[model samples]
Target: MSGRQGAAISRDGTFDAFDLCARRATLEGIVDATTLPRMADGVADEGGLARVAWRIEGTSDALGRPALEIGLDGIVPLECQRCLAPFEGPVAQRTLLLLARDERELARLDGEAEHEVVLASVPLDALELVEDELLLTLPFAPRCERPECVGAATAAGAAEERTSAFGALAGLKPAPKNE
Candidate 1:
């Protein structure tokens, strides 16, 4: 699905406290080209849509700006790296966000390279963050348990060709030998 959108930020500059109780969040109107976080091992691929939910908690900083913590639980459909089959699984992660009131603070926090820093002048979309984190959590290389996972055997049934990309050139004729 394409054109999906994340949960909307509220006008109050804070997520509705009641939303945390709903137990579900629907992200809609997002575009297909959007990318998610991926596992460093190169096993996980976030090439498609994701559905998510989160439990949120928050408090105020010294200036009364909202600071939020989110615990995510969700599911995503992905293709197996080995079998090339599609499957669905759970995605879980934790994120903390800081809401900034002034443009200067937002710019300052956004410029920081620290991993934990997330700056927003208004209420941030927790669902988007959760989706992205799930992408990051994916395995670098997902594989199927079956011996046929790589399609080593029964090569004909495999979805992909077994030969190397250069195989075609190998068959080309060499110059003729002396008569």
Candidate 2:
């Protein structure tokens, strides 16, 4: 497996979770946004690359169970829900996940601790992890905060004011009142 400055830990995007944690390994790479299929639905356009950098360090929680500290950061292109414009959203996340040997252990760890717990499964897909973290960090309804977007919003409101809700009814008039 490679370190921070080298190639990805694995070409297939999978890695041994326990082994990485034990070795305190770091994997950093740049992946085109288009490569992440699931993430495509959330992005406005498939025209940018995301910088994925992560590291797994060994740790022990209060329960003395094996744990891994994952630190991830990246930037993803997203469409502003308000203006329908594309923008860049930054992702920065850190999580401590307890390694559970089996489903029973996973349930037990989850019930006992506030930290997240995952099965210590081998060959975990690193890209999927990165994608998940990035997705979580994204805003539920992203809106561009730039001055241009603000101006666009103002223009939209003005356009709305020029049109009336009753405009469609203006063409039709009430029939002559019954005498």
lDDT of 1: 0.50
**Residues 1-179 of candidate 1: C-alpha lDDT, one tens digit per residue:** 22222233454324543333232343322322124333322323554555556555554434444555566666556567656776565566665555555678767766763434455543456545555555566655555456666555357544235364346566576757898
Worst 10 residues of 2 by lDDT: 1-10
Report the number of clashing residue pairs per model.
15, 0
> TM per model?
0.44, 0.69
Per-residue CA lDDT of model 2 for 1-179, tens digit only, reads: 34552332567877676766665656655566556778778876754665556655556667666777767766777889877878887767898778887888889888976887778765667667667666777788889899888888899988887676567577587777898
Q: Which stretches of candidate 1 lie over 4 Å from their true place?
A: 1-51, 59-66, 135-179
lDDT of each: 0.50, 0.71
